[model samples]
Target: MLKDEVLKILLSSGSHVSGQDISNKLGVSRTAVWKAVTALKNDGYDIESVNNKGYLLTKNKSILNEAEIETCMHLYDCKVFPKILYFNSIDSTNTYAKKAADLIPSDFLVVADTQTLGRGRLGRSWSSPSSTGIYMSLCIRPNISLEKASMITLITAMAICDAIEELYNISPLIKWPNDIVINSKKICGILTEMSCDMDGIKYIISGVGINVYDTEFPDDIKDTASSLLLETGTKTDRAKIISSAIYHFYEDLDTFMQTEDMSILKSKYESRLANIGREVMILDPKGEYPATALGIDETGALIVNANGKIKRIISGEVSVRGIYGYT
Candidate 1:
C-alpha cells in the first residue's frame, strides 16, 4: 500500500526525486521507505535503489499490474481503471467483461496474465501463454450506427500497427479484419465481440492478444505464430507495450470520435496490411476459384481482384493465406 502511494507520487512528478525527499513528503521513516522499495521491486517494478540518493523506476516489470498502467495513462480523460479487476490467469477477458458489461464503466480494462480459453474472430481458441504476452479487453459503448460498427476492427488494427512500429521498430502487416503479421508470422490478433438489445447497443469488448516472449510456438503454429522475443531476441516489457497500445488506443479513439466513420482509419490500415497487392489464394468453401489480393476496402474488407472483377471480403469464414509467404 505504501508502495502504491509512493509510486503515485513518483509517477506524477515524472522526474527523479531523492529518498529523503520522498520520506519527508510521505511522512514515513527512511527505513519504511526502503522497505516499500524492496516490496515494489519484488512485485516486478525494475527500480534502481541507490545507496543514499533515492529510487529510480527504470521500468515497470509488469504482471497483473493495474497501478503501473494508470501511471502511464495519467493524461487520458476516459478515467481508465488500471488497478481494477486484474488477474494473473483467467479464461477470457472479453468473456469476463461481457458478463459485467452493463455494470462497469465504458473504458474499464479487464486484463489477464494468461487465458485458459481465450477466443478469436470465430470460435477459434486464442493461445495466451503466461508472462509472455498481453491478454486484455476493454469495454466500450459508442453511439455509432450498426452499419459503422464494422469499422471498429479496422480502427483497432491501425492502432495496433502504430504501437508496434513505435515500440518495437517493427512494421507488422495488418491482415484485414484484425491480424498482425511480422516476417509473415502472426504476432498479434484482435477479437471484438458485442452485446446489444432492442433499445440500442450495450457495449463491445475488444480483446487483444500478442505473443511477446516465446522463441518457439506450439507445434500446430510453429510455422505461423511468433513473438517479439523470438523475432528480436530480447524480452519486451509487457506493461510498456500495453501502455503503447493504450496510448494509441486513445489517439485512434479520438480520431474515430472526430470522424465518426471507419473510413478515416482505412488508409493507415491498408498500409500495414501485408496481404495488400500480393498474389494470394482464398479458400472459399463454395468451391469458387482463388482470388487475387488487391487491397482492403474502406469497411476493412479484403478486396481481392479476382478474374477482372473485384471481390470484397467481409467475413472470416474465407481463409486468405499468402501464396508466397504462408504455406
Candidate 2:
C-alpha cells in the first residue's frame, strides 16, 4: 500500500520527488520510503535516483500493473472502476476471466502483459509478446438475452476504434464483427465469449488485444499484422488507451443495454467498417460464398450481395483480401 501511495505521488508529481516529502506525506520514516522505492523498482519500474534530485520515475515499462491501471481509470473518470487481476504472463486473459466470473463483480477485468497461449476467434493463435501489446478481458453480467450477446462484440470494436482515434488521431477501421484494422493491416482483435441459460444471460467476457509497440511479427503474419507504433511511428501511452477504451465501452454499453438494439451504434459502426463495399469470401458451415459487402444491418449482421441475391450473413468466417489477404 505504501508503494502504491509512493507511485501515485511520483506519477502525479511528473518530476523528481524527494524521499522526505514522500515520507512526510504518508507519515512514515525516510527508511520506509526507501524500502517502498526499492520494492517498486523490483516490481519493474524504472526509477532514477540522484544525489540531489531524489527519485524520478524515468520510465514505466510495466503499464499493465494494477496501480498504474487504477490510476489511469481514475484519471479517465470511469463510473465504476473494476477490480483488475494483473498477470506478468498467462495462457489467456479470456480463460482466466471466465474462471473468475462468478467470484468477481460484473465490471471486473483480467489483464496480462503476455499470453503464452493467446487465442482469437475460430481457435486461432494471437501473438502476445511481453510489454508490447494489451491483452485484457472484461467480464460483464448484463441482463440481456443470449441472442443479443453478439452485439457486445461489435460494441467493443467500436470502443477500440474510438479510443485509438481519440488518442492518436488515427482512424482505425473495424473488420466486420470484431477486428480493428489500419491501412488494411490488423491492429486489434476482439473475442467475446459468454455463459448463459434460459433465465437470461449470466456473464460475458470480452477479450481485446491491441498491438501497440510491437514492430515485428511472425513470417506468416508480417504483411497483414501491424502495431500502432509501426503505423504511427511513435509509441502510444498504453495506460491511457486502456482507460479510454474502458470508459467509452461502458458508455456505449449503457446505451445498448437500455434498448437492446445495435441500431443505436449502427451508423457509427457502419462508418468505420472496412469490409463494406469490398469483395469478400464467406466461409460458412454449409458452403462458401463470394459476395460484396453492403454494410451491417440493425441487428449487427453483415449484409452482403451474394451473387445476384442479397443475403444477410448472420455468422461466418469472412475473409476479405483487403483485411488480411485470406483467400
Candidate 3:
C-alpha cells in the first residue's frame, strides 16, 4: 500500500520531491519511502534518483499490476471503483472472473499478464503473450434483459476506441460487434458472455484482449493481427489505458442502461465503423450474401443494403477489403 501511495505521489507531482517531503506528506519514515521506491524500480519503473533532488519517475514501463492500475484510476478521479484481481499469468481471466462472480463485487475485474488458453469470439484462440498484451474481463451485473446483452459488447468497443484515441491520438475503427481495427489489422478483440435464466440476467463477463507491445505474433495470425507498438512505434502505458477504458465504460454503460437503446450512441459508433458505406461479404449459416453496409440500427444490428433490398443482419461474420486488402 505504501508503494502504491509512493507511486501515486510520484506520478502526480510534475517535479521531484524529496524523501522527507514524501514521508511527511504520507506520515511515514524516510526509510519506508526508500523501500517503496526500490520496490517500484524493481517492478520496471525507471525512477531517477539524484543525490540532492530525491527521486523522480522518469518512465513507467511497469506491468499490469493492481497497484499501478489503482494509481491510474486515482489520477483520473474515477468515481465507480471496482475490485481488481490481478495475476501475473493465468489460464483465462474470463474463466476466473466467472468462477468468482458470486464472491466478488458486481464491478469486479480480473486482469492477467498472459492467458494460456485465451479465447476470442466464436471460441477462437486469442494470442496472449506474457507481459506483451492486456487480458482482462469485467464482471458486470446489469439489471437488464438477456437480449440486451449484445449492446454491452458495442459499448465496450466504443470505450476501447475512446481510450486508444486518448493515448495514441489515432482513431481505430470498430468491426461490427466486437473487433477494433487499425490500418485494417486487428488490434483488439472483445468477447461478451452472460449467464441467465428465464427471469432476467445474472452476470456478464466482458473479456477484452489488446495487443499492446507485442512485436511478433503467431504464424497463423501474423498477417491479420497487430499491436500498438507495431502500429504506432511507441510503447503504451497499459495501466493508464485500462483505467481510462474502465472509466469510460462505466460512463457509457450508465447512459445505455438509462435509455435501453443504442440510438444514443449510434452516431458515434457509426462514425468509427470500418464497414459503413463499404462493400462487404456477409457469411451466415443460412447463406452468404454480398452487400454494402448502410449503418447500425437502434438495437445495434448491422443494417446493410443487400442487392436491391434492405437487410438487417442480427449476427454474422463479415469481410471487407479496402486499400489494405482483406483481413
Each model's TM-score, in the order given?
0.86, 0.91, 0.91
lDDT of 3 by residue, 3-91 (tens): 97898888877788899999999999999999999998888888899988988888776567888787787777565888888899899
**1-327, model 1: which lDDT tens digit per residue?**
688777766666655667888899999987888888788878777777666656788765545466666665564443233334678888899899888787765467787888999888768888888877888887778776655566777777776778778778878787766788888888888988887766645777778888888776778888888887787676656766777777777677777767776567667776787877777677788855667777766666788988888888765558776776643
lDDT over C-alpha atoms for residue 293 of model 1: 77
- Looking at model 2, the pairs that clash are none
Give model 2's TM-score versus the native structure: 0.91
Superior candidate under TM-score, 1 versus 3: 3
- Whole-structure CA lDDT of model 1: 0.74
Is 1 or 3 the stronger prediction by lDDT? 3
CA shift at 268, candidate 1, in angstroms? 1.3
After superposition, candidate 2 runs with Cα above 4 Å error? 15-21, 24-27, 43-55, 316-327
- Estimate the lDDT of model 2: 0.86
lDDT (Cα, 0-100) at 127 in candidate 1: 81
Task: Give lDDT per model, in order.
Answer: 0.74, 0.86, 0.86
Candidate 3 weakest lDDT stretch, 10 residues:
317-326
Off by over 4 Å in 3: 24-28, 50-53, 77-79, 316-324
